[model samples]
Target chain A: MLGRIEQKVLRGGRLTPEEALALFETDDIHLLGRLADTAAERRSRGRAYFVQNRHINHTNLCLNRCRFCAFSRSKGERGAFELSTEEVLERLEGSPEGLSELHMVGGLHPEWPFEHYLELLRAVKERFPRLGIKAFTAVEVDHFSRISGLSLRETLARLKESGLDLMPGGGAEIFSEGVRKRLCPEKITAERWLEVHRTAHELGIRTNATMLYGHIESYADRVDHMIRLRRLQDDTGGFQAFIPLSYHPFNTEIRGGRPSGIDDLRTIAVSRLVLDNFDHIKAYWVMLGEKLTQVALLFGADDIDGTVVEEKITHAAGALTSEGLTREALIGLIRGAGKVPVERDAFYRELNLYGDRYEDRQGDGAEAPDRFRTARARQ
Target chain B: MRKRLHPEGVVTFVVDRNINYTNVCINRCRFCAYYRGPDSPEAFVLGRDELFRKIEETLEEGGTQILLQGGLHPGLDLSFYLEMLRSIKERFDINIHGFSPPEIHYIAGRANLTVGETLQSLRDAGLDSIPGGGAEILSDRVRQVLSPRKIRSAEWLEVMEEAHRLGMRTTATMMFGSVEGPEDIVEHLDALRGLQDRTGGFTAFIPWSFQPKNTELGETVQDRPLGAGGAEYLRIVAVSRLYLDNFPNIQASWVTQGIKMAQVALRFGANDFGSTMIEENVVRAAGVSYRASRRGIVDAIRSAGFKPAQRDTHYNIIRRL
Candidate 1:
């Protein structure tokens, strides 16, 4: 008899909540990987999408210090730092030329007014008008709405006017109430986080979604989280990609080991299967490390996030993957997996298509006698 | 080794049927399971009705050609091949990619004609092109052990070189992972490379693993390997692309590797998806039963991130999708 999940997958039907939970229990990692890979291939057509962008974490000091986060620091604490507008501009000046996006997300600050964020965005945009600024997470947006006493839509619009081109998908630590209450009770509720993104989508602001996994979250909780993201994507069509952030537990209140490589891959594969409406599924190399992210490309991940320079949040949580990767190195990683390395921009617009070096040799029977002799001698 | 050797993003395949006309091969090689002795129950050539039926079905499936290759039947005269080709050409507007180098050599010897004269006669009867059959491993040592009664490596190249001189195009193939080692494989490739250097008449090079199941050779080996997995297949494909510089196209044999690995081959220097074998018997007789329809080939090519196209036997684009 065919298993229910297999039946659903073979029929190309949407995975139900129960079926997804069942699939999450499957130990046949290759099956799940193949299923996810088939789905990803159908969508992306063998081209893994990535971007040349810079990550800017503006501040690490926050009022709501979630247990899962190690970057948020109390006021006056050691290693606590916040970037002023001048400091942000100075950091921007160090970014490599031809960067297409500026990704910014940091802790919720207690004293900085909403205008501080606006001024920082404006200054960066004035410096590089072509750079798409994908700043702030849903939690940051909600915090902005609350502190500024503006509606979610109004706050998003004001930020949009202030040059916030898109929203980052973060702070959606598993959508289950139990997981949220334990890991981050002070943070916004799961419903509120979705509502913030929904409002952003309604305001014509494209956003990405993320789920932090491998920390006190059940298989059911992970499935439910992705299903909810898929539901929102179905309604809004706003989520550009769904990223399953592997939880890092170094120097954090939540004391547990990091997710195993299999766990990380399973989550990524399950995300690709469940988030059917999401076009891109990302393996954030920063969180999952570089090796696992490379493997995740075959496990249904078509995006390796980006060449994020100087990432602090995951690095603070003890991520051992390099703080940054060169664009050439990133292209090599994708090519090593036998995929076309496409350099995409902030909005997933393909900036440059890096054709593999071997693909260009036309072999026009053009023979160089010396080179042929050398090759023959070596063989 | 992801190279775009072709300017067009489209990966081309031929919608053709590999219709074996005769199973009564005189050389009953040890590596083959499809051939039979003339007295065997299955050692019968396809009658005109069966041949026309296969052609009709191929055309119905939107196939533009038929890969008509067969064993060297001892009794069948060269006139038999000519009449079959003429009848197919008169009846249907399908390309007849008939006869391989070995078959051409055998037919010429039996009819007391030169290889050029034989190929010209077949071409006049509307033999559009030739399939690269029976050029398994162009190393005589491998050929002696695998199929001793068959033509030698040089004779195979001689037939192809002569066909090219007669203005006829053909494909080249290698059936490796049998008794051939890396040096022998290189020798095989070197022969094709050398011949192609002089006469660039070869359209593509297809390297497929020797399917061992149900074959006499499969039964003879005590510890038979799993043939060529994707990694080995990919390595050969990559090397073939780098080595066979004179050849324009490399084909991924989905008949033996299945569709997914064949799709992966598009990135591994294979610019063509061989053929959607509407009717295949050789590999099927070897106990690997992978089938590809026209739509399946198109989807496989597209899934591999290339535009899928239909091409003629000569690698000319027939239609692009």
Candidate 2:
């Protein structure tokens, strides 16, 4: 069964939902990873992408207290926080060195009007004009539409006009309604999330899609979610990346354990094979940790999703990785996985390419000995 | 190589539970998540009742042996281990494969005895075999960084050699994907192969990946810890099978890798599915939990196109499933 899927994937053919599920169930993990690697290579060659970005979760005071969310907090909750426009600028100003992108997402604040989000985006853009702002999710966009008394298109258009360069992929936890009801019933539905992204794409705003796995969602649910995103990409061609968010079970209402490494890699590999229309697949290092992110490179993830200077959402849910990674550390991770590191902006355009000689020429004393290189040399 | 080594077309596994006798350890290795400081509220040395209950459950589940291992408790001496072992042997007719090299080394030091004396005493007191738990990577360069408080590479090898010399066969293990280089891995394999060449005491070689979820090492090497992927695991298992010519068996660590990866490892030169692990706390403390029943393991092996057999501690098959 997996053989047929492998042949199809090798021939640059799209995988059926059934085929994708079969790949998920197959014990031939090496083959699945190899096929995903091949597909990723076809898209991005040997280049692995990361953005020098900072994550500013503007507020944690949320209206929709999703069950799976550990980041969201109710009004006046103990840890609830809402960053002012000045504070957001101060945070961005703290790290301007090689910072090309600002990844801003937060909860749907119950009291904050839609103008507050627009103003925050404008203020951030005015302060750091060079930094591309990839802000908000489809769920957030839907919330803005409801809060602003405007249509979805108008809400996205207003935000885009106020300097939102791209949209992040969150809140699309799992598209399966049965699971989504259990996970985030108060949050936007699957159709509403996709509609927001579809409307954003139609307005020339490229966005990323995500699926939060290792929760209650089934394999069929994941395949359905990816196919839906693929269909949207086929129509609008504006989906920039696909990130499979591994569910972290820490301070949350839903207290399932974290996903195993095999499940994480399988989701990444299967996403690569299934989402053929999506150009980039990200292994979000904040949730995956540094090591599995490197392995995910082999499993078809091309992007490690930026420096992410203070990732709060996953950390609130019990992520063990550092909040942020340095550029050198990112390069080391990519190169350690035996791939070329391509520093990218939010849109994944290559800002700098660190080839094999880049590290040797730099001669950084802190560099660990490249064991993969040594192992290959020995072979 | 697998075909050459096991022409019988059978994959063997030991149905046993790893009972962590205690969580209190002096040698709190940076890479270890199982050990707790003596003063910690969670620190515990299992009471006799709890230990007996675990053993009784293992026996009820058709487990032929108990992989009894624990942390190097500062307060526990050789007499404590001896008494525990004698009591278990007196009650249950089951093999007690307890005490890794580090624990043995620590117990010997506490009692002011040689490694040979320690192994002989423990063997005499119902320790059926030694498990390979402490040999993370047999390179002092890596060992000094990972486990400076624990025994050095030579001491780990010496303990295993002494156990072998005392006619007690032991298993060999390598916990890769930590801070070690590939040369360190090769060095580890070389040490095991060289020792096996002299004593021929190792019954099997088990190589598992380092789970870096909740350990001090995981936080220290936060950016660049190589939590080795499945391919890296397969490569290591295949290389171990090819390199460790003197060793007879290679175990697929389904506890670390999931069952699918372990099944794939059968073709990658692993002959044994490690253990059922009716209860495993060490790896779970590191935030990875993979459970498999005897029937689940048997079905996995069968689906992977190999016959499954239940084996005792000495690699002797007791039943073919």
Candidate 3:
């Protein structure tokens, strides 16, 4: 019964922790790996992908004091900062050229009119009409909705009309209230975060999902986070990927915390093993560094995040990354890991291999059934 | 190699900077939202001067080591690393605890050298040790599905073993919580345990969660099971101490799990508080929140009902915990 559901949920044909831990003690490591490998491989079947874009932190100024945040700057703080559209556009221009997407998000400012964001997107679109904008998290959306007295749909629609292509997965720190209250109490509740994402999906705008792990949360809570996301994905099919956000406990409001390496690995492996509906398991290179991210691939992560020509919020949080990247460097890292380097669009669709041509990216349309069958037979 | 963290009278610890020389990478592993492509204006390889400046800063701050790691970029040559290591050694008094399994594998493949020879060359060039990295859930099934193109389970261990025999001490790791079943977790443990029984080279075993942000995978499924808590984290810590019987010191993962869990881990299994990390990115980008001070490590260990001891990268407790 246990293995049955395990396979159904993850397709890895493994048993639950309660069952597997018992066998692990007895040194049945091979059987265990087989089961985990299966589940991980199948869970993210077509979705292990990454995007080519840049991240823009419009402002670190905020009214709320979310506990888990290290990047938020109170308006009165010496470190508080807000970028004008011109400043943001300068940052965008400095963004790696040929980038098709712009990832914009920051704190929910109390003073900036909601239309400030709209205007920012509008200006960017007018300046770079071809570039897609995947901006704002659910919490930011909630902040905008309340501040503007607009419905979630109306808000998203207005943004879309203003060039908001999609939503960036943020603010879903964890689904458990116990943890939320202790970690980020002032932020939108987990339910509201989900509601906004659900609303975004309902409106036909795709978004991403994330979990900021390695902080004050439990294994069950991690599992609950995944189950809830799976259910949501089943409902909307709007979530394009699952990025495991590693919580960095530095310059943050929280106390008594540090990063957990093993826990991070467990989350990634387990995510691929259990999140049967999600496609991609990304190692956010910015957070995990390339070494762990590369290792994450073997553990069940297929996608490495894209070129962040400029990542502000993390830098403001003291990420130490002050420079952007060139595509050659990225391809070098992927190929160095012995994986094929493919560039992806804002959505999960494959644009082509890093070095492949547009025509080469042309999906061969449905693998010749016989070819895959033969390949499987060869296996 | 007697790779054991034997407690000594002096609590020896070294100051180091984890120089991720470059954020440029090709592997688009989900759970990662970092890494820029070549030509990505964001992309960069730490030039010698830039790296030297970092080392100079660390040295100025009394740092004695450098844990240099980066994505598996194809352009870097063995000479590149050799030059960097040589430069660091030539410039400052620093120990190089750099490179992981996948990196060695890539280096070997790129240079057409064996893992043993690769370690041998790097060690000859002032490379001191390897971190417990990329040993994410060590199941081929999980590896193929998640990072299909990276090293396989056997390869990861094989590289570690090669490092062990090559006289390079290394660490083992398990990244759980994604799609892995309990059995998969077990398999990861057993693999590490068996390796320890053989080579006894793995200095410590660390486990962590996945961080999904700014990546392709971050676009799909909502991150579930949030993250491990003190209780669950302790359970794993205790289990590792209990399970990796051949392994002696299990380092509490203060880097990803935080100090509270690290303190709790001492009771369960972990005896060593990890390095006084000057900089860490991978897990932080995934959103794990916290940083530990050297004094904080001492305090946390004391609070956890143990003496806080400082140790070198080799697990030899210089200070009593």
Candidate 4:
């Protein structure tokens, strides 16, 4: 017999908490996959989207060393590093000319004034006016709010004025109160993290959402986390995508095994199904190994992240997936799945449509990398 | 593969009975063990009461359609088909998915009507869709050796074209692993693809192995393999998904391959589970009795990690689990 919630799904209605929880309990993983695929297809059609961006972790030195975090460090811990505004710009220079976005996130620095972050964003904008700077998780924002003595709205407004294009989805490890208490006690509360994004959305600063799974959280915890995000997406509509971050356990204070491949795929499929209103579901290749990332395209993930160059967050957690992939390689993965590869910007605008006729944008004679440099230099 | 392709995680099946209304056939294809000649005492055409009983049982089982197919009985006229369709449609308000191309061609020839006229008369009598039966291999070379007395390949395509022109939909099938090679499989898929490109009327593609037991062709075709295995079936299903890009849905034949292989095929690119066959006689006559109830199909699909959804004849979801 059809469950009442599943009957509503058949009738094209949104999922309730009871329905969401029931979806997890049901043994029908394929039905979960099918529902996720239907939702993904409804949003993306046959096109799988990715971007050409670089990740810049400004600093690793921090005050809050959350147990799940391997990237955060004490004042003089070995491998602790911080980049100045000039160093950040010099690193940005090495990126390919077609680089469209910058992903920036790091620990909560103790002594550095909030002016350092403002200057970093300003310097990045001054050097590459065309770059979209997606910086700061809600945790970092909360830290900044505490240090600067500003409200969430005012803190977000100041960051937006300083060239923060969007907010990176992080700090939402697991939403259950017990999970939050156990996972990252020093970090902002789950409600506070959501409030930061909610305020960002209300201020017209679109952001993404994420959930770190396969750790201490139960299945109910994961479902409740996604349901909260779904409800938030329903209210503000500022969430562009949902990335289900698989918990990698290597150097963390907690010692647990990583999720299996099937678990990763199931989480992605369920995330796609549960977050119906969100347009894109991302498979961060930096966390899910390269092959699984390609497989995830066929699962429920339409966005295989981007050419992340140097992604230190998951690497700190002992992730085996390569730190980055080239634009051509990303396109190859999407096309290998028999889907159209579209080059999208941070805000989901089509930068280029790489149809059946694939023109190598990296040094190919047809479309040279220097073309982007020339176009930007003209400005 | 299931999640990326469908994203909605809903795998669907229909609760319908494959009612072989008549077992008497004139074109008795060699590989078929189901048909009986008119002179045989065992030959039978369903009486009105029996047909209604089957249909009522179907409704009681929560079935939404009756897939009425059979051999081309020379004694039966077009009036018999028209009345059967009208009777079912008038009484039950259920979908009448009756008649393959060969049966339609045989009816047209017997009534001295054009294929279009025969389809129109059937449609007027409340025929909803055509099932792709008798399409063993679209290659005529194989057809010549397989079933020469049946309508040729061109005639089958012609009947489908006429049905599509009349704005009616149909399903396509390939009965492989019988005297045909890899090229023949490609040829079959290409033929279906070409027609789909023109008409865009095929709702789904079904591929099943040719069952050969207690049949003359099974013994006569020396050196020929009996049928394909699960691996081969999966390879063909995956290739069909890649080849038939225009085709929206591909079905796995759980009725032939059994439940386990069908469940595995969900990963190999089959989005639709063929049917919960409340009644199946044709394949059963060939000495393979694999039964599937609605609950069984739902369980199998759920085990495969997909949500089971009930669908009508048109592939529209009636309910979801």
The lDDT for every candidate, in the order shown, is: 0.82, 0.85, 0.69, 0.82
C-alpha DockQ of every model: 0.01, 0.15, 0.04, 0.01
lDDT of 2 by residue, B177-203 (tens): 888889999999999999999999999
Q: How does model 4 fare in lDDT?
A: 0.82
User: What lDDT tens digits, residue by residue, belong to model 4 across residues B110-147?
Assistant: 99999999999999999999998888899988988888
Candidate 4 lDDT over residue span A192-300, tens digit each: 9999999999998999999999889888898899999998998999998899998877788886655644567678887777788888899887877554565567667
Candidate 1's DockQ is 0.01
Q: How good is model 3 by TM-score?
A: 0.56
What are the per-residue Cα lDDT tens digits for candidate 2 across A1-379? Answer: 8778878988999889899899888866778889999999998888898889998888998888888888888887798899999999989889858798888888888888889888998888888787889999887888888888999888989999999998988888889999988888898898988889889988988888889998788889999999998898899998889999988766889864456566788899999999999889999988776656877898899999878889898888767667887876787778767788887777676667776544364445433333222211100
The segments of candidate 2 whose C-alpha lies over 4 angstroms from its true place after superposition are A1-4, A176-183, A214-218, A249-260, A357-379, B1-118, B133-162, B165-167, B175-187, B190-204, B208-234, B241-321
Compared with the true structure, what per-residue lDDT tens digits does model 1 show for residues B54-166? 99999998888999989889999999999999999889999888899889999999999998899889899888788788999998888889999999988899889988888
TM-score of 2: 0.75
Worst 10 residues of 3 chain B by lDDT: B1-10
- Give stretches of model 1 more than 4 Å off: A1-4, A358-379, B1-321
**Total backbone collisions for each predicted model:** 3, 0, 153, 26
Candidate number of the best TM-score: 2
- B112-178 per-residue lDDT for model 3 (tens digits): 9988888889999989999878788899988876677678999998988888887778888787656
Report the number of backbone clashes for model 1.
3
